[model samples]
Target: MFHTLKQVPHSIAFPASNTVESGAAKEDQAISITYDKSVTLVRINCPRQDGHDWVIEAFTALEKCGMAFDMVSIQPGEVSFTVKSRLVDSVYRSLEKLEVYPDSVTDCVKLSVRGRSGQPLLSSMITMAETLAQCNIPLLRLVESYGLIEVLIATGYISEVRKALAKNFNC
Candidate 1:
């Protein structure tokens, strides 16, 4: 049965039959994935009283050693970052010189998921997390920023994680 409105304020047409599918296609085009393999995650323990100082010192040491790092996370008594797997030895040596022992995970990879402009940050994050969870992927560390989510995970799961995200977001 079809019923007509008694009054119409403004004319609005319902979405086309393919609207939902088209929206998913747009999301697939708007999302992009990038990654870096052969990365190492290093975490250094510092005294709470001097954690900040230790962090600065660690940076300086890395600089002196001519090693570059990223994904640096600093907490009250801990600092973690990533460097090229090739530089793990230098990183460990440099830290040892400062009497800082750091635990590290080698054979890691960094994955970045970028969303198009105006995308909802929180929703995108939640969706990404859910996608990973559904795939049984373990996220070692996660960093979220404007329109971007970076995750560190074991290199072995890179393909699986990427496939899951691509499937979930249609990317």
Candidate 2:
């Protein structure tokens, strides 16, 4: 499931200044491959009895920690998001203050696959997923915008994932 790309201070994949000219490549072309190597995937499982109020409280606690999160996915019993890997202890402390414990995978990498302008990233997503599958890299999460697809995976497999993507897309 995908939610709005909401970061506290609003950091997005592509800024307004990045524009495509008339002869840019098609959507399948990979413009660039960028990554953040200091991310962690944090998943908090709330008791079904707690309902959705825990979601609000969890966000409040995280905000108090001055955390900027991305790839936020919310479901009935779980809230999954990514934060700086260095902040894992801080996240744990903040949530534990509310008697909530979160499961986290540190040393995660976020890959941003930017495509050509005027093309939906839907197809690129499938290709990227297939590439990852070929490399045996598990995709933790994925989200796409008009010309970008952001994927989360364990940092240990970053090299293999990057190599596979570069081979498949010539990035």
What digit string (tens of lDDT, one per residue) describes model 1 on residues 1-171? 001112212121111222332355222225445677778889887844753877888789889978888888887788888888888888989988888889999988777655445352334556667777898888787878765677889989976875665566533
Q: What's model 1's lDDT at 135?
A: 89
List the candidate 2 regions with Cα displacement exceeding 4 Å: 1-27, 116-122
Clashing pairs in 2: none
Which predicted model would earn the best lDDT? Answer: 2
Residue-pair clashes per candidate, as listed?
Answer: 0, 0
Alpha-carbon local distance difference test for all models? 0.68, 0.73
**Model 2 lDDT-worst window of ten:** 8-17
Worst 10 residues of 1 by lDDT: 1-10
Highest TM-score among the candidates is held by which one?
Answer: 2
Candidate 2, 10-68: lDDT as tens digits: 12222222233455443344245567888889999884475788899999999998878
Q: What is the Cα-based lDDT of residue 125 in candidate 1?
A: 56
